[model samples]
Each structure stands twice: as structure tokens, then as C-alpha cells.
Target: MGLVIIFLLVALLAIFGLVRSIKDKNLLGAFFAFGSLAVFGWFAIMTIIYNGFPVAH
Candidate 1:
């Protein structure tokens, strides 16, 4: 759960970076940000689906 939260937070930051990079016309930065967003977002979603939030003890 904690890992999921951290992943989600990083994904959110990646989203922000993606937007900023696009506005600045920085292709490389946008690419990296997009990659980060995909990886982190996927991990967070998968974790939630597999383990369930507040995971049972």
C-alpha cells in the first residue's frame, strides 16, 4: 500500500513534467516523463488490483 502510494505520487509528478516539457517543446524531457508516467502508473494500478487497498493482514 505504501509502495502504491509512492508510485502514484511519482506518476503524478511525471504527469506534471510531461505537461511542462510539452509546453517547453523539450522532446527528450517529454519522452522520459511519459516513460516514467507509464511505468509508475502501471505499477500502482497493478499493485492495487492484485493486493487490494488496505491489504488484508
Candidate 2:
């Protein structure tokens, strides 16, 4: 439960970072933001696929 909530919040932040970088037109910032987003996104996808949401004890 907590992990899911935290993961969602982090995901939101990553998206926000990406958007802000784009708005500022900073290529380096955008690249790093996207890289960070990709890392988290991969973990999210893996968790969803293997453990599933709401995670079992």
C-alpha cells in the first residue's frame, strides 16, 4: 500500500521534472529527467508484471 503510493508520487515528480525541463528547453536537463523517468518506469512495469499491484505479503 505504502509502496504503491510512494511509487505513484515519485512517478508524478518524474513527469513534472520532464515537463519542466522541456519548458525550459534544456537538453541536458531533459535527457537526465527522461533517464530518471525511464528507470522508475521500468521498475513500475516490472512490479506490475511480477508482483502485481497492491503487492502480496
Q: Which candidate achieves the best TM-score against the true structure? A: 1
Question: In terms of TM-score, how similar is model 1 to the real structure?
Answer: 0.90
Candidate 1, 10-56: lDDT as tens digits: 99999999999999999999999999999999999998888888655
Model 2 stretches with alpha carbons more than 4 Å out: 55-57
Best by lDDT: 1
Question: Which lDDT value does model 1 have at 55?
Answer: 53
Q: Give every collision pair in model 2.
A: none
State the displacement of the C-alpha of residue 28, model 1, in Å, after optimal TM-score superposition. 0.2
Give the alpha carbon lDDT tens digit for every residue of 1-57 in model 2.
566557667777888999999999998988988887787777777777786678457
Q: Please give the clash total of every predicted structure, in order.
A: 0, 0
